[model samples]
Target: MLTILLTAIVIINLLFIYTLVKDLIKHKDEVMSEPASTIWTPIAQVIIYFLSTFGISDFAISTALYPKAKWVSMKKLPGTLNTQCVIPVFVMALAYINSISVGVTTLLVCIVCQVIGAYVGPYFVVKLPEKVIKNFVVVGLLVASLLILAGKFNWIPANGTATELTGTKLVLTGLLMFVYGALNNIGIGSYALTMATVYAMGMNPAAAFPIMMGACTFSVSIGSMQFIKLQDYSRKITMMSVFGVIGVLIAVFLVKSLNTQMLQWVVLVVLLYSAVSLFMAGRKESEA
Candidate 1:
């Protein structure tokens, strides 16, 4: 199942790479470093996330959510955006959270961590320069991409199913989830962190899914509200996000059958593209 899923994801993403390259060529005059949107970008993301993630997964949504925010920061470019994460985050949450249950304790823990992350993340964002912010975001994307690839290739072993945690270990795990707020805001997103932390505590990947998705919804909501209050976001992209929910609804029932290995490959392609784009933008800035 792992091998077949990985291969399918690879094939799907290889085609997406072609699409990306064509778009890159057409947008050569536009700033390549910015989170760009056409009418199609968000629509395409929803489709890809549905096909690859089995539903409106958090990482996929957050990944979609970041480009708008990326385009919003520092000097606002004309087509750039700030994610109205609140509407869209909950959109996916509504679509998928009810489909699975990970117990009340885990759900509550995820909610608290995410709420804290959502509120705290923006403070960190406003404190930094756009260039520095881009640097961290880009580097973080690369790190995440590598981690996803590692998991796919088994360069680092996937952990066995976990047992419940308690005591000090739980506290330490809590720290990781809290920091994920900052990381997710910085464009690192939260899936890798959730997978590592939750799976480490003994939950299998399947059990971890709903919790991670719920946590990110809260995190992005808090963070998005902060961005919205600042009045520093794009309305155009928000429309794309709203439309993207169609894709989420289409895949809601498919969540239970998803293969983890394939999903990681799809994520890997998106992350690698994001990481490379960030680096290219930084290099362009440096040359200027």
Candidate 2:
């Protein structure tokens, strides 16, 4: 069953990759008009690499790119989000493949729920008010990042050796992942939330990695289609996706010896700033 599931996810992800590549080629001429993207893309990818080294996951890139998209076009935010996720999803699936065996049933539940939510998410996000989407991203970033900081400081209790969840805990985790999947459409990431949820439910924190990765892999790939069909994303964001992979490679191979604690601290600081910047941007939308 595990092998079958892995096979399915790999095939699906490949198909999504093909779709994104085709779009990239078809729209290669459509360079983003916003000059700011040229400056922000490299900066954001650097931040993503730093955060990923600390095990922050693809949510880091989503948070980084969403604001950049907002600067260019509010309508493209969702599409930019879906596009940005492709590289991280592929990288994570390969990196975390072994961890999936720890909680196969729970992982399956999350993937199913999140995939459904992801499929329907783009429709709602595109219609949402600019203020609403921006506010959602701000709140999501604040909540998720703060939770991680809180966990580090031992402000939140989460100590469990269990590898899997059962019964009511399983149901609750599924529901939360579904919400996270929907939120992902608006450029909100599920990594911290999924980590928090599974940890609180007494599952091993290690298990959360694979569960979150697998869920996101299926959900984002399925969700990107909606954004593509709507033509609601910026075409130029694809270039940054290449840089994102490079960031991950450097972090994993070149800088693996860096201080993990310091990296986490730096990422938390960036996430907080991102939250504030997004809040300010949201206000600007309201004023405009």
Candidate 3:
């Protein structure tokens, strides 16, 4: 069974690579304007999933290189939000391909955090200045990056959550989710934050994922519904999410094949990149 699984993962990875190459070739002429190439939506989603599986929660990374040139239009954001529920539900229901564990307790925490955050997020936006919230996010990202490095270099003792996940640890995890859920409405990547926080707590990437992805669905759904009600979301871009379903399946295959340690390495690289990107974003915001 394990051998079959590995073989399948390799095959899926190859297919994804093939498609990515094909897109690059086809878009070679127009590479500058759409430097990300054709099939960019899935590429972005894949990178977002890969980096965020730990703490690099960026939605912009289309690949190891070649990211989207800029942010998505806010009108397009809600239309694509459907992927949040679809992918996670597919993952949990399958539960074998990409994740290690999908604990009921973890899912519960995620759901509560996301729903409350989503429902209340607009209020927070109204209350707090956008720049202030973003500045705080930059600081938090730097702190998280340092935490990952400390763990890597053995510079500090383990925070207990890294050793054993207790009830308190779990609730704190949910609170982090709540914060991510709220900010996600404004373009923060929840997956990256969730992955980073859970890793810091010493939970397995597999376990962290189900909780992180599963719960955030509620927040996205709420936002999507609002956009639909307000008629502010773009149906065309939303329809493109269907194109990413294939990539989601491929990602499940790829991640499932990785054990905890490999996932950790991939995640660390992503965390560092995300930290740098956050700093860049902060600088841009400051200049503005």
Highest-lDDT candidate: 2
Best by TM-score: 2
Error of 2 at 265 (Å): 2.7
| TM-score per candidate | 0.71, 0.86, 0.57
| Alpha-carbon shift of residue 246 in model 1 (angstroms) | 1.1
Off by over 4 Å in 1: 1-38, 48-85, 155-164, 254-270
Give the candidate order by descending lDDT: 2, 1, 3
Tens-digit per-residue lDDT, 1-288, candidate 2: 788878988898888878877877777667666443687776776667455534675565456556555554655666676666676666666567653456778888999999999999998888988777767767777876787788788775577788777899989988998998998898777777887887788877678768877888899888987787777776666556667777666765577555667767766787788888878867776799
Q: Pick out the ten consecutive residues of candidate 3 with the lowest summed lDDT.
A: 59-68
Cα lDDT tens digits, model 1, 1-288, are 323422433443344334334544555564334464565557655664455244323443344345544534433211122243334444455444555545555555665776686677666666667787667766666767776666666665456464345667567766777887767666566666676666566665565666666665666655655654554444444435555566555666545455656666776677677667767878998999
Compared with the true structure, all predictions reach lDDT values of 0.55, 0.74, 0.49
